[model samples]
Target chain A: MIVAIASGKGGTGKTTIATALARIWDGPRVAVDMDVEAPNLHLFLAPSYDGRKRAVLDVPVVLHPEACSGCGACSRLCAFKAIIALGDYPVVFPEMCHGCGGCLEVCRRGVLGAGKRELGEIFWGRAGAADGASPDLRIAGGQLRIGEAMSVPLIRQVRTKANEMLAEHPGDVIIDAPPGTSCPALSAVREVDVLLLVAEPTPFGLHDLGLAVRALASGRVPTGVVVNRAGLGDDCIRAFCHKHDLPILAEIPFRRDIAEACAQGIPLDHMGELRTMMETLARSLRELAEPRVAA
Target chain B: MSLIAVSAQGDTPEASVDPRFGRAKGFGLYDPSAQYWSYLSNDAAQAQAQGAGLAAVELLARAKVTVVLSGSIGPKAAVALRAAGIASVEGADGQTVRQAVAAHLEMPQRGDAKS
Candidate 1:
């Protein structure tokens, strides 16, 4: 089963939950970090993989220095306004360019040419036995280059590579999605069969959680929630769940050790209760995947 | 010269009635006769559902070159136009639709036009 762990806000322990779950379920599993813009899962997994492999997500634009006749036809046809004329020459902003190649097709002079810009890198590694030995669990993630704004395409590339890895070793897949309910998060969520939403008990958390929940519901994916740092906040999250008919799968209390371990690049196993809770969460997740097992 | 349509959004030719907040709304340029931009829209609504923006295919169906005069566009729209053999232009401001079109037509051609 494909399981995606997501949160509305950043720093709510979505990666912690995803890594812990992967560690607990000792089987053929692939942990894919689709937070392309800021992939941090590798900090915990520490798989000794090769150096970065450049991944490019090309955006199309018109190179006016070539065949562009200043006909303005390409500009007139573009819906995104990606093209603009400065004096007599047209300049293409690589960041804003989507690589649509419309300029090449529309140019009466056939001036447009294809060009690519590097967006990010996809890394692969195996978790060390000392960290949390799971021969079956292989970790792969994508890290977007800083200052790059296009995240959905990079996330899509990560998912595609993860899918390719899974095909080779057929097993359960757990995806750590980026925070928020935007296109990047949506891209991660769409590929999963089950979704685990990690939410905090703050007002902001609740608000973002509602957005995430709405996005998941719109996609018709079965979803559950795990309230991280549960002991700090009131019962607003619980009440909201009750009213919305959403399930509260687990509640992780606030712990300094967990925070320290994360800061020190240590896994959740360093904390006793958090590890146990993650194990239980893993079992429940398996049950959710195979409901008939309960019967 | 083939006709292409452009929208205010950067590269997505898809027609959206309501350009989401922070997203630009405008026409997309493409070779209208080639039907290349149609590949951008996964469904009919995305391609032709005219709430606010124009689909890349729809833009291509109308014109050969598109001049984007808006703020931004999503990646899907950009990829669709590239695949359909469309040309894209960006950074168009302070100009009306007619002025943008006129500027594009006056630009120099890079190579011989394809048959």
Candidate 2:
């Protein structure tokens, strides 16, 4: 089953829950970090490098300065403003380029050339348990190149590459999506069988949670919430869920030990209470994927 | 021989020059030799969220306008206009399109005045 761990607010325990669940699956499983901008799952899983590859996008380039004809057509057609006609030729801004290739289509003088830009890299490795022995679980994720403003393209490539890897190995797929309601986050969550939402019990968390709920609900994706750091704040989150008819499948209480372990890249599954919560979350997600699995 | 295009706020040549070049609401095209003038919208720029200057250059160039008078022109659009053999003159913002056009005509004749 494909599951995505997401949150509207950052630092709400998406990575913690995702890594823990992947470790506990026992069966063949893959954990994909879809947060290309600041991918941190690598620190938690500490996978030994197995494979790496670059991802690229087809961007347009200005060519044949003599053939430009000073028409400014390419610049006019570029919706992204990546190209500008400056005295006889269009100047190209690689950073602003969305690679739409619209300039090439609009240029009658054939001065626009097809080009590619490296978006980022995808890396995969086998990770061992806390004991450092059985490296049964494999972790893979995307990393966007520094100074690259676009994350959606990298996220798309990461998801595709991870899917291919998982298909070759065949296992439960869980994605730790980037924090937000933006396109990058949406791209990561798309097509997943279950969306595991991690939310804190604070007011900011509550506000962003509502946004997440609305965003996922509009797409009609099945979702459940895991209230991270529960009991630290008021029960407003629970009350909100109850009113919205959204299920609160698990609650990871605010604990000093869990927080400390997480800081050092340790999984919380070894803890009894947290393990039960993770199991409950897994079971709930399984039920959604296959109706035969009971609560 | 000079055809001037002023980024404009209205249809009449008397309309004030629109300060923005790439996303001007409309452009007033004027011919010095024929004493003819008209207005055309910068459609390409208006259609999208970005690259307004890039898009606006196309219509200006296509109309065969040799000179552009406006409050401002972006670097990208400026490059396009220059490559197309168009000259840009600034600081006619808030001036009527007709006045901006007339002002441009007088600058060259005076020769010593800064454009």
Candidate 3:
């Protein structure tokens, strides 16, 4: 089963919780950092280098400018305006293209050709086993190339690569998704069996968490909330979750020691209380994934 | 008769020039030969979430506009305007459309003899 850990607001400790869970997961597990724009899970997981590959998207380029009929059909048909048919030929902007191939299909003259645009890189390694010992967790994720506007494609690639890695070992997947309820975040959680939304208990956190909850209200996956910095703010998040009938799976309280450990790229598995809490969270997550197991 | 389009806050030449090119409220178009002014509402481009500049450029291109005067033009819009053979003059903000057009007219024309 695949579980995605997401948050509506940044700095809500998604990577902290994801790394904790992945380290202590009882069975074989793969942790995927889907926040390609700024992946920090690597700092915590410390996955040794295993494999890497460049991710690309196919965009159309003008192949034949000489056979010109400046009909502007391709420009008119393009919803993105990535290509514009000018005086004699269409100028192509690969950055703006969504790689939909609609222009090529519309071009009767076959003026457009398939072109590849580098989106990002997908790299995988094993975390917690740099000494050639059995790895405690498999790590896989993607990083968006700088100045790349579109991150959904890279996030999709990370998810796909994680799944491919899982096929080799057949393990549970834990995806640390990016913040917000936008396309990149939604793409990370898409089709997952369970989603654990990591939320802070502050007013801003409550508001953004509501946005995320509303965004996923129509989704079929079972969702539960894990309130981080639980005692630092009021119980508004708790009230909101209770009003919505959403279960509170766990809460990581506001503590300086935990913050220091996180800052040092240390997992909470070494802390007694936090480790027990993560173990309990693991049980709850497994139960959420398989109701029969809990029954 | 060349046409000039000024991104404007309102429909008339008396209105202030809109500072933005992509999300401008509207355009006040002037035909120099006819000395006539017209308004083109840019509601569609203003409402577009992405590629508003390109959409606005497409609108001007469709209207056969030869010159665009705006405060700022985004990179994509700049490219599209250059491709369409339309000249762009930036930093036209805070001025009335008529004043902006008058100032543009007073500027030295290309290929004119030096004083």
Q: After superposition, how far is residue B74 of candidate 1 from its true place, in Å?
A: 20
Interface RMSD of each: 10.9, 3.1, 1.3
Model 3 CA lDDT for position B48: 72
lDDT of 2 by residue, A207-254 (tens): 999988877645456678899999999898999989988788899889
**Per-residue C-alpha lDDT of model 1 across residues B3-63, encoded as one tens digit per residue:** 5343433334434322331233434444434545422222432443221123443354344
State the TM-score for model 3.
0.93
- Please give the range of 10 consecutive residues that has the lowest summed lDDT in model 1 chain A: A84-93
B1-115, model 3: which lDDT tens digit per residue?
A: 5788999999989999999998999999998779889999999888776788988998998898888899999998998888887889999998999999998878875422221
Instruction: List candidate 1 segments past 4 Å from native.
Output: A61-73, A84-91, A100-109, A290-295, B1-115
Give lDDT: candidate 1, residue B39.
20
Model 2: TM-score for chain B: 0.89
Query: What is the TM-score of each predicted model, taking all chains together?
Result: 0.67, 0.76, 0.93
Model 3 C-alpha lDDT per residue in residues A182-259, reported as the tens digit of each score: 889888888787889888989999998999898754446778899998899999899999998888999888999888
Best by DockQ, which number? 3
Sorting all predicted structures by lDDT, with the top scorer first, yields 3, 2, 1
Model 2 interface Cα RMSD in Å = 3.1
CAPRI rating of model 3: medium
lDDT of 1 by residue, A1-295 (tens): 8889998888888998887887777678888899888788877777777445788966554544655566667666655555543324454556665556676677676556677878888887667667654567788888888888787777777777778877887888889999988888888888466789999999988898888888865535667889988877788789888988878888988777667777887667557777777777777777665642323
- Residue A140, model 3: Cα distance from true site in angstroms: 0.9
